[model samples]
Target: MTNISRSNYDPEVEESEYDRLERRWTEQLSELRVTQAGTQIMMGFLLTLSFQPSFETISLFERNLYLSLVITATLATVLAIAPVSFHRILFGHPGAKARVVSITQVLLRLTLILVALVLSGTVALIFNMVLGTTAGIIGGICAVVTITTIWIALPMTVLRKLR
Candidate 1:
């Protein structure tokens, strides 16, 4: 894909608002492709966990945690992937790009939530199996902190500073 340079953007040039939005959204779709691929790989791994022998040895709480993680991962996959599928279905259709991008934004936010949940659950499950509830609690807290630091706090701080 060719990168859109600052020269390509001219605020003074008049275009239909819809067309402008579509162009911006198409750019966003390109940016999100890498994020979609990473999430899909993680989701694929989570999906296959139920078939493992260790899964049977997991406690009821741990099993529930795993199930929740799987569900979250599935949702995350769907959300992360929606943009590509949306673009494919709506290609060449007038007024589709803006709508696709709008839906994708919502889905991307949902994907973040699911990703955090899956990460927390996975951490808890591993600790639960190896060292019981106390360790699981500590691991869960660590996971939450990690997600918050990387996904929420750092991004918010950087975005705010940029603004």
Candidate 2:
């Protein structure tokens, strides 16, 4: 997002569309690999929380919130890693590059949305257990709004301006 990073924007680089797609796919896949690792770790931790000794004392609302967070986190992990499976299943087949890259792009976008939700839910669940429901709602709303603005809206605004 800075000028130092923007120095690589070689608008003059000549390449076929297929080649561009291949490059983009590689770059996107690498980015998603980092995301997938983090999401998997979160999912694993969430899955095991119910077994903790102190977990049995939680209120029903807190227990339900934790379950919902685990489910949402699981979905985020699935969405984050789905494109990898998609690529392997179709790799190098005729016309697969374009199709894989296009689908992966959409999946990546959806994965980010899921990640934002997972983060918001985590914040809400934790705050609800620790501070109370009102604080939980406020924390969740703040997290979702901040992530949406920074991750989605800011990029969109910049893209619109460039167009």
Candidate 3:
């Protein structure tokens, strides 16, 4: 184990599990607010492309890619917001906080993956439309690399070092 401890947490301070769960829930909710905003913006941008005149000129592959992006992005949005819905439904029930947090964490991870795909798809679609199929493939690869490095590997490395 990394033996990591919270910078602001005081070991001397006694707290109940409920209290801990409440604090964690609050923190995750705040984080969700940030993620949800980004998802909304991406989805909004993706939605506008369907109406573009150039949209009709895309190849079957590009059209499928766009459609997949729309689906993935929408699913990401829903998954990101699922915790709140789960919270509302389970609020005040016994062990509600723990249940909500656990469920949300899994959903959040899935949401990240879908969001990553949506981002890569968006890049590929635009680059293909503007530059060429080869350029679009390059763009998609770049987006995937960027997201994986910054979102997963960087954090995992920092965590490993802390451990």
Over 33-125, each residue of candidate 2 has an lDDT whose tens digit, in order, gives 988997898898887878889799889988888888788888878888888898899987999888888888888778777788888888887
- Determine the backbone clash count of candidate 3: 1
Model 3, TM vs. native? 0.90
Summarize candidate 3's per-residue lDDT along 1-163 as a digit string, tens digits: 1355677455335668778777778878887898798789899999998998978888999889888888889999999999989999998898788999889889888988888999998998889988999999999999999999999999999989867
Error of 2 at 120 (Å): 0.3
Which prediction has more favorable lDDT, 1 or 3?
A: 3
lDDT, candidate 1, equals 0.80
Clash counts per candidate, in order, are 0, 0, 1
Question: Which residue pairs of candidate 3 clash?
Answer: 2-163
User: Model 1 segments beyond 4 Å from truth?
Assistant: 1-23
Evaluate all candidate structures by whole-model CA lDDT and list the values in order. 0.80, 0.84, 0.88
lDDT of 1 by residue, 75-106 (tens): 88888888889889998898777788788888
Model 3 ranges with Cα > 4 A deviation: 1-14
